[model samples]
Target: MSSKAYRVALSASGAALGAIAAYWALLAARQGHILFDTRKLPVVALSGDFSTYSHTVPGGMVRGYVYHPHGEAALQDLFVYFAGRGEDVRATAKALHWLPEGFGFAAVNYRGMADSEGHPSEIASVADAVQLANHLRKAFPHARLHVVGRSLGSGVAIQLVAQQKFSSLQLITPYDSMLEVAKKRFPLVPLSLLLRHQFNSLAHCIGVAAKTQVLLAERDDVVLPERSAKLIAAWPTPVSVRTIAGSDHHSIIGFEETWLLLVDFALTAVLAMPEAV
Candidate 1:
């Protein structure tokens, strides 16, 4: 081909690459919104006595709910829960019924969700977790604390565990990283380069020392079965893996068996620490 023709071809290829790069950048900028669904939902009455708590963070305040066992006056054991994206934690007040008596239950609403203020981002959420954990630790010095996270919250939980020690750690339908999930969904995009909020749970798991349990949905399609498998394989600490039968991504939490397994794991140390698979 002539030199002029070759130059023209090269110019066209460069223009195409620039366009793709711009598109990826736009996607990256909107990642936070895509990752966090903060829509407010109808509030449901809690089963037992509970109190609302709030903590100030950069930009705004983070709100959450705490439930106490029927007869308990002191914090015997604490359970800190992190719900999935798009979940209105106020609706999760019903979960208090499933928790073993004597355990204090707490769940946080991400920024801009429900009564919480400010915008939500990966960094801000993790920072808020740390702040909340520290506050709870000081408030109940003698209580044994356990952390439970579902879906997107799993990433936040892992990061918290890496920085703080807990009695136990529970993850439900977690992913290795948001970047990995994005890559799977948008294979042609350069997510690794453009992703701004990369919640790399696999990296965060390396330093977690707490006894861990991973609950996987048998038919998970949102996070993918392989993604959860990858995190389980990469976990440095001993972790017990259990699958909820006949459950998918959205329906897994609705099963009675799911709550039974979680409550049992949280309340007892009978779960043998199997070697990481």
Candidate 2:
């Protein structure tokens, strides 16, 4: 009825709208897909003898698919992979041809992903990846275990490496930390502090004593390509790296040649397998 009353009503509406915006932002961060723009490859038909194994994690049963061809002695080195957020590990495993119709490769689901249980925290995924890798290593005692993490998953691998030494480390288009990355993307607001998932890959990567390798893409859209290069430069030891010629962040992993380069790195630089076997 009065001009003062009308002003008050407008103020209340603005406050409500701002609250809605804040809530949506919080939901986005919790989803943990800040840079996860790609779809995981389809599940490939297993061309090997290994079977899928499921184990009880704290929250729920986490399943891992093992692909090892029959009678092929497990190479001292095994590749353990952590797929990016919203992506499944099965396809990435098959896409890399890690199973190769004869060798063993293990792909794990961190909590909150398919078949895995519980909410995903940045540290929890890192811990989960390590736990699953160890389980696979013990199951196949002959194999040497290594880790590969892609994008956000790279942070997971880095954390695991900080606690335990892998045969080698491989990171694909990883960020320095989830907090820093969010800050950069949402400079207008304080997203980093609001973000609950703080995967600090840069800090953890430094602690790894194992031979480390990084894959960078020239056109990475998710993470700055320069940052990836910087990470390599910052490593105390000489971390081997290869940049995909024309690939971007999401497409790099699925490329045919990318797999070739990865296989080469894992087998030669990291694994040190004797060619005779």
How large is the C-alpha RMSD of every model relative to the true structure? 4.6, 3.9
Report clash pairs, candidate 1: none
TM-score of each: 0.85, 0.82
**Residue 93 displacement in candidate 1 (angstroms):** 2.1
- Among all windows of ten consecutive residues in candidate 2, which has the lowest summed lDDT? 33-42
What lDDT score is found at residue 160 in candidate 1? 92
C-alpha lDDT (0 to 100) for residue 112 of candidate 1: 82
Model 1 CA lDDT for position 276:
17
Q: Once model 1 is optimally superposed onto the true structure by TM-score, how far is the C-alpha of residue 54 displaced, in angstroms?
A: 0.7
lDDT of 1: 0.82
At residue 192, give the lDDT of candidate 1.
77
Compose the digit string of candidate 2's lDDT tens values, residues 44-156: 55555557877676768777777665553744556778787677766565564534433456786666565566556776676667678777767777666778888888888
Task: Estimate the lDDT of model 2.
Answer: 0.70
